[model samples]
Target: MARLPLTILGSVLFVAGCAGEEAPGPGGPGGPPPIVDANGVVPNYACPGSPGCEKAEGPLLVGVAARPITPVLETWDDLDGDGVRGDGEPFDDVNGNGEWDGVWLAGFAAGRAATEIHDDVWSRVLTFEQGDVSVAMVGLDLVGYFQQDVVKVRLEAAARGLDFDHVVVTSTHTHEGPDTMGMWGAEFGTTGYQEEYIQHIVTQTVDALAEAKASQKAARMKVARGEAPELVNDTRLPEVIDQSIHAAQFIDEAGAPFATLAVWGNHPEALGSDNTQLTSDYVHYLREGLEERYPGTTTVFLSGPLGGLMTTIRITGCPDAAGVETCPQGTFERAEYVGKGAADAAIAALEGSGATIEDSPSLAFRRRSFFIQPTNTGLALLVLTGVLHRDVYSRDKKLIPREQQALLSLTNVKEGDVLIGTELNGVHVGPLAIAMVPGEIYPELWMLKPDGSSYIERPEGGDFSDAMPETPIQAVLPAGVTPVIVNNANDALGYILPQTQFDDAPPYAYGEETEPQYGEENSVGYTMGPTLTKEFAAMYGR
Candidate 1:
């Protein structure tokens, strides 16, 4: 899960111990591996006439997994046989009858990669520094990026010698996963058949980071949070979201929770959008329920920022309970009673959130880069007013005229290009912040609380701000501090706009009020949730 910040930290959200460094204790396997040493990955080498400061020596920890992998490339028609598919090169199998349709399917792709899920696993995490600052916690999987493409994956983890203070790239928004994205959203992973499944997903993330770095060890690092709210649900609408669970166990020496980081939000898509089968949904029921209730832990799922969010479902149509296909638009026992209540609320947030350990002599992880402002009108102008293209999200799912999305935004992004939006404001291993905002947001701006004047402060309860309470943690730290609103995860724009509803007002008003009525797609819209939190604390300076 890598960029777009719609929401779904994981589900939509992993370590060990000592000697040759054998970890297992903490109520885990047989028990006893938590020693600690060799911590390296330094690289910040300051540039552009540097005054001087090029840090990077060791004690780093990096992880990655960029989800969305539903590969089904090739289907054809266009030049408008009127059979449908936006019109033209529509991918090209042209009814030779190979199988993808006159291609009513509309979307299909597979190009983009920089995968490295676990090459040397914790990539770097052995911290020792006590004063100034040298924290650690690096993991990525991405989703939304029209700016800084996750700062080119954090300058490729600081050109390989990382120096993070919370580089949490958690995403599993598997709308069948793949297509790190190339404009017109949700087109689904491209191909040469994804070149051997993206080289077997970067060789199983570099062989699970060389088997978790030949299996590192040490221990202690626990933190628990609660509120499973019957397995998180809200799936956006004026419904505002954020189902708080925020765990991060990581223990050894006798404590427990070998490695866990749950994080939450909604919309692993629960397996629909026409699924072609190639899943991670229910994330193997959260890695077989955290390996049958803590049997030598190692679970990592970080999804949130579910832009317009979803999942208080319980199965209203298809893909219920991980089957991958359930349709009818609404019904399947409410999606299998909300996918068996988000897998029994992620196994009661891992057997009731008491998982302790963060031993901290001095643990820190730093990453900084803030500057976002591109949206003559979001979605590069709805794809330059083509009204949200990619075949209008595959055949008219809805919207096609800002003058026809301005002719695909006059040919995609130019006239002063660049929209920054990078948010990962981390701290206290909680009260998190992971923005990527672009479109679908308006679920009451996720908590809308701006007062002192400047926009949405209207809270007394009667309309304006204060609705998003499905479970939005609230961590929001960057400048001063205070953050938490976990949605789908990296870059999934799609919806979000709460400045009193825009588009020349009248019909709904300010920031374009509860969108979905113009064409009727359902699920809910308009934009800007996470309650605009001081306009994202003044767009990330906090």
Candidate 2:
């Protein structure tokens, strides 16, 4: 397959001042010079060096911490079934005093209120430090987290004197969690996100970071990869599934497990849409299974490139918690089955073929902020109507003040005039290279054969048929290194697929009789796939 060149120059910045060059003074001669991209914007870096660059001094230290972030439910029952909360709507008289009170469950559809708490959701953090540089990876059990909230977590951490070089806040994309992104409210255009609940999440996240930082201890690392395709189902045509599970296990001096960071590409929605109970879905079990396997060890689960709608929905014949062979969808049994199955796969890979890194492996990272043009009218309406609370940027990457957002309309704004500001992060810890994507990426964008060919073929009728496949993320990294592509890392802009496979307009691709596939409807726009792939490849100077 032909690869697309790095054409999105403004989105990527090259590292200046190579190794052996005189380190500039603090604030003058010895300090690092400002590195700018093609657009003349300064990019953030963990160290003053190239991509995956590191400056190690002391032994590697690792710590893990978690805090419950379940929201206190205050929801109004939709009596009229109009998908809107109104004055006449009845409240849960049994649970409360006939007043509206419940939490909006995100993912499948709107107005899905949480009836009960099956399991608690969490804000988990894994901290790493090898020298002066420190990085924090926060995993939240939610459908999606906006970049605006991520910024709040960073600022709060800084205020508490717990500053890290880079912080990657990711969501597990649990369909049963509270709607933090504001889309899945009681109605179609209404916002389900509660300001107080979002604040609670932010506070808990920062607390987890602080706790993790204080608990850091000297540790070693082990990296491994396993395959569990049977646990994942591709709901879209031209099926491509990322069955690989990447794990990084940290060990203390006594060889006791400190924490295990598992990365996989499957939506945590095994409980399905009709269920109203609030839970982390399969993620709760995935973490529980791992922690039980290694007592006293914490496990952090990060969702990977599950954009082509990789899920456990409709997957049958898996053993349930009671050892039953037949597990059905939308049941707690199915969720447990898939979660434990994934946990078992990771354990087998870690114990059987895990590779331990040398002591005190260097840690470094790079973060770039770029703009994605919005093409979906529904998404734009959500932003304009104040249903989606996020900062919008102009073509020049300037923030369009929220006050002025009301005045903007589809007729006034051109196709590329309005943009969404998001981030792409890359981290290197010894031989492991981690790509932190801002949304659910398609598996084809991350997985590639050794010869740089995709395992899946492009469909026949895409919007961009002549478009070349952007270089797969794994292909851009150094050879012989373990790669972990984390999706929904900093923000959730919906599905990120290849531009060549973007089929928003009919005649639909994959021979659909009517409308285009499901992925495009939730996506920000067609440019997401190309923009992310190009920027990611350029981040590594591919």
Candidate 3:
């Protein structure tokens, strides 16, 4: 743990143990009364470095709800407002089968529509309220969300008269879900987006959030952190992974647990690409296991800084039912093993870890956006050909040309100045400060590898090295404050890789025989890691 800043110590002591009362346990009664500020308005217990932390006077309130987002093939309608459905519009046979039902399952490039429904997918919402301000965190069982879609969710909720200071939407990055983003369609550059299905997600998310707010209850929070190395593996270069599993549980005043949020970094592809069922991957199993172990707890699994290829590739000693041993990777049994293993680790951490958030904890949120030049020509071609659905902005924030002809017509283009919108967010919940990444973030960008190696060598004149403790999480957060990265949060821009790795990776090729690089296949472009790290540091006022 880093050293806690002077201001952080003051803030923690300000709310520590709450006025002559013992700190409450996960299953204990409220510890102390709400502390009031000079204005008599309950002073928001803002952490030392948390920007835009909202203050409220009252007991903590939390609500948890979920809605089904499973797509009904029979009821699948026009999804993109393009007037007609499958009438010569670009539709790829993702699974390479002759028959095409126009459903592109995300996560795998071998485009396959959902052939069967293994289980119903869901959109889960966890809403928190303090005084007049409220924030909602939504988790969907999908591969990723575009920035436009992420913003649209907020806008749609607002249009429906739903009010919130912030509504953070993140896809669980489940490989088994429908292709919400257009990238995973049948063809290399085509889209399998169904507008109706997207609308269903938007509606379910808003509705669930509304119901959650309506079902608010006085709650106390307990946050604990533990490592589950057996559960996650890093497949990309430098072999770095964030094994830290952070669990935050909100216990209602009645002593019944309601909502639990867990953060980890492994890609949810435990079932691999061979299966054709619609599922939330290991996430569904993880949530089910956690809820079964602790009844009535709504569990939300968020991916962490796993951009440089973190996954469940370290398959060893996994066993299937009937006491038969299974392969180490890409099996349903492996998925269960990972999910149940994570649950066990979480239970162990929560049971004995002595980290307790206050009964009336402070809630604050901060967000900022930046632009990176699209350096990969292959990706640029996808953007130009109307294949990849991403909105590019100019230096002045004007919409850049995305159409093939328009982009081709422009001459003498400076690639670095052609901005792609990316964003980062800092959300403070009690003593936990969450750093949100819009894409899959490489763990090396935030922390140094266990072997003391780094993603990038220190620049000749730069003050900061490209390593952990120098990342957005450490730079923006005060020392001793709990920090976690919510990768693929709000928007899935793509893989945010370090500049050095980006340079080392083979050049991007749009043609049939592009050389395989470590992390560029799913990346937007290069140099995103440095840009995000700088912006995050600035956002937290480091």
Candidate 4:
């Protein structure tokens, strides 16, 4: 397990810029345009009453909206074995035609095309505005959304005259949804992404954001945390499960509920890989249960730290739909049970626990762009072969032309040779501090005891057995603040784990025979864990 030289690209601050310049598309001609300025810096928007702002004081305005993004399955037979439905490939006429449809289910194995829709997926948005500063937090029911798609949504929102200081988009990381990240397509080299469906998602998401913004109302906020270890399972060793559910409830001045934001960790794949139906999996049930309990309130769900392979796959001792006391593996009943159980925990925490409700809380946030040089050769091959659509940059931040990328070999991707730009966003909504992480962050990175020591024990024979634990996010937050960490936000670069437990080489971390532990194969690289933790700490001035 040889390590590559680590390169630290400085952060790009968001700043106000001149108006009327046409914003470039995703990975535009030269590169992606600066968020606002010519130098590619995003414009910052601070709370009106704080610091150098010039606006009258106002109450917190909140709004929520949802748009269905369920993909319409096209009847394609793929008769010629090529992924594309060419002219000669006729549609299968048989009633029980098992030919692969256009909708490829995201997680688990490839070729898992969707044959039916069990539940509709969506792009749910929650918008908040205090004085002039406004921000939108979107939760999508999908596997993962790339940075390229996020950029497209931002540009589209701006084009539609929607002005927001910042937008944070996150995915529920549902393994049952349609493929959006391109890796879970039909074959190894071929992508299963539907360009038309992706565009539909972007358009619908922007529209949802606009709707939420237009429907804002003065609201008060309350936050709470609940724990339910019975609903989550950590497959990897050093079994540290993030069983806490953080909820933020916004209420209208008239006492009606505006929206309830629920953040929890665990893969939403309760239905497992054997099912071919398209669904948001357990997330659909969670939202349903919440909305049912709190009438007139929209429930928005965001995934928390689920990296060290948090999942519902082999969980045991749970009651199923038939009232049988057993873990319902690969069944829709298990998804419902887990989802409703999470909702119950959230409700109990918010109602029974003594939570503080804040009025006129100020909003402050910071978003910075950083780069990571991808070390996963499998990921590199996917990008180089056009299976994954994204822009790779050189050490000098120059875009590597597509033609050049196609010609480059796996060995050509050396230290600092191929970099991908992602972002980290930190926001303060009164006493609630939200950290928007871009991938499946391992729970060990954030879980800390009162003494500030990691809760996870390092097993012997790990790849970096002597590596120091990165700073826990909770250790740097201001006193009396509740930390709400959301993962799969803005981008999904795979598992962001602790370097001490990265087990890609021989003598794996947890004594697994014949293969390394589950996480590293899908991760961007070993450097991602250290890089993200350091940058996250720097963002908070730790």
Give the per-residue lDDT of model 2 (tens digit) for 253-359: 99888899999989898888788889998888889988999999999999987878798865664765885668688889889988988898998888884555656
Query: 174-282 in candidate 3: lDDT tens per residue?
Result: 8888887666677555666666777778888888988998898888889998777866776644566677888999987777788999888878888776666788877
Better of 3 and 4 by TM-score: 4
Estimate the lDDT of model 2. 0.75
- Return the lDDT, model 3, position 103: 61
lDDT of 4 by residue, 211-274 (tens): 9999999988888889878888888788887788988899998877869999999899888777
Taking every candidate in turn, the Cα RMSD to the unseen true structure, in Å, is 23.3, 7.3, 12.5, 6.4
> What does candidate 1's lDDT look like per residue over 65-112, in tens digits?
222223334544446544334544445553367443321111122222
Model 3's alpha-carbon lDDT is 0.65
Instruction: Note the Cα lDDT for every prediction shown.
Output: 0.35, 0.75, 0.65, 0.75
Off by more than 4 A, model 1: 1-58, 63-72, 75-98, 101-486, 490-542
Name the regions of candidate 4 deviating beyond 4 angstroms: 1-56, 75-101, 320-327, 401-403, 456-458
